[model samples]
Target: MSKWKRLQENSLLLLPSVVLTLALGIYPLLWVLRYMFYDYAGYGNELFIGLDNFRRLMKDTQFWDSVGNTFVFAGGKLLLTIPLSLILAVILNGRLRGRGWLRAIYFMPTVISTAVISVVFYIIFNSYNGMVNQLLLKYHVINAPIDWMGQEHAMLTVILVAVWGAVGNYMLLFLAGLQSIPNDLYESASIDGANATQKFWSITIPMLGPVMQMIVMLAIIASLKGYESIMVMTEGGPIGRTEVMYLYLYKLLFPVSTGSAVDQQIGYGSAVGFATAVIVGIITALYYYLSKKMNKVF
Candidate 1:
């Protein structure tokens, strides 16, 4: 085909995605931008009160608390998930018997629904009559049943669940990175009197640098945006202990049950959404800059 004809055909193929983006992404964003300056409750008249929502957001303690909780949850999940995933990837990448079965088992969770996982975990960790408590009691691990959903331990419970759901996905990524590394490098290192540890540090890690960087970036964004599992498990409470940024924004935009109905705050919710986006964007940009600098060094 002629170059012009090929280009025309490619544009035709891309038309659906372009149209969907404009309709679902661009239009909603514009609508939110417009309403951020108004006081609308998803109905009635929207009164223009420019910057009022932003002003309210500045002093909103609950939302700020949720932001702090998000960092904690994300930090805990990353600290556990990334290292565990890399370790699993390294192990499973080796030529062990039934390694294929092990890989399939580990990756199975990644294909499962997050909501289903959360619900199953909820039942497993229930404060009373849960499998966890039952097992602990059976083994005399605890004197009494601990409330996993209570304020004191709710965040910890949520973090564990988040890590469980996330590790499998990152493991697959790490496995791909591990496999891409040529065996020749390890052989050369072996000839140089390098041990397994030395090979991992010098060859495996450095060889996987590009993939590692991308995986870390993706993990950070996913962790920051994570709220679905938290929502299903904790509903951002016992007293907002497990609340995260997106969940807080969701509560503002939609009605939530917290011993009472939460009135929709569309205008303020839009402002909160914008602020949340800004926070995520800043973190992502900072990481990108640091990664670029690290690339220069190594």
Candidate 2:
């Protein structure tokens, strides 16, 4: 067959997928772009307002609070999850009995539903009858029951749940990266009188740079977009202290009401959504730049 014929056949094979993606993904994004410029309640007439939505976002205090909360969530997850995953990957990469079982145990949480995990954690962190407080009291760690889902501890609790759900997947990624590193490098390092820490710093980390970059990017995006667990556990409650961007947007679009009334602010919600998209885009670009720089250093 001629090269032209082969190309035509390949294009035919890909056409369905391309069409589906445009219909399901690209069109929705275009719709969001349109909504961002319009003042439209979901059921009302949409007014073309140009950059007014963007301007309103600048003065939205709740949007800023949600932004701050998202950062805290992302930062906390990154700090705790990445190092923990690395350590777990390193340990599991070593020669040990029951290694497969240990790896499975670590990864099991990632396969479970986030909503289920959130509900489980809600019960575990209950102020009066939770297992965490009961254990702490039993061990003499605290004199009284602590409210783990309260405003003071809500953010921390959410962070911990995020880390727990994420570490497994990242550990698996690191493990695959670790496996790809040749044993020859470790032998050479050993011959050079390099300690474990030295080998990890000079060899393992540098070799795993690409994998680390991918994991960090995933973790940041996940944390920034976190909602399900927070919704199930705290519902951004205790005076909205744990309200992240997505939750705030959700509430804005589908405002909770009393009795026979409905409250809707579709325009404001669209504004928040657009602002979040901008922030996430900037963050992703920054991550790409930093990853490229780090790759160069490594």
Candidate 3:
């Protein structure tokens, strides 16, 4: 076939995907952006009230509260998950009996459905007659059953469940990065009288710079998308204590809230969604830029 005909055929093959993307993705995004500047409830006429949704969002204390909860959840997950994942990866990367089984067991959680995991964790942390409380009582750790999912401890439970579910995927990623490090470098360190700790600090870490940075960025982004698990597990609270930005956005979209805050404003939801997308974008860019700079130092 002539070159022009070949190009035309390729374009024809790509047309369906392009159209589908526009229909399912780009179109909805544009529609949401349009609604962000108006007062719409997915029904009657949309009032073209300019920027009012965002204005209300700015002063909305509950919205800001959700944002704070979001950061707490995301930060807590990263703090615990990353180190645990790295430790697991390092151990699994070593020569050991039952390594295959161990790796498979650890990585299985990451492959499981988030909803299933969250539901299971939810049951485990139930206030009364739950496994966790039962264990604590068995160990004489507490005299009575503690409310694991109650307002005072809900965020803690969410963070714990998140870390348990999150560690596996990052462990797999770290395992891949660990395996890729050249054996010769370790041999060289061994000959230089370097201890295992010394070699790990000097060689493993420095060489894993890119991988570490990648894991950090991935974990941050993954934690931001923790809505499904949190929703399934907590439904935003014992009293809205576990509400994150996405859950709050959901509440707005449904005209749902703890009484006195309910309003069927799809426009506000869209505004929150837009702001969230922008925040994600900014964090992504900053992470990559910082990673590049740190990689140079390494």
Task: Say which candidate scores most in lDDT.
Answer: 1
lDDT, residue 4, model 3:
100
TM-score of each: 0.96, 0.93, 0.93
- List the global CA lDDT of all models: 0.92, 0.88, 0.87
Top candidate when judged by TM-score against the true structure: 1
Q: Give candidate 3 misplaced runs (Cα > 4 Å).
A: 255-263
lDDT of 1 by residue, 104-152 (tens): 8988888899999999999999989999999999999999999999989
Q: Candidate 2: where are CA atoms >4 Å away?
A: 256-262
Per-residue lDDT of 195 in model 3: 95
Predicted structure 1: lDDT: 0.92
Q: After the best TM-score superposition of candidate 3, give how far the Cα of residue 256 lies from its true spot, in angstroms.
A: 7.3
Clashing pairs in 3: none
Estimate the TM-score for candidate 2: 0.93
State how far residue 154 of model 1 sits from its true place (Å): 0.7
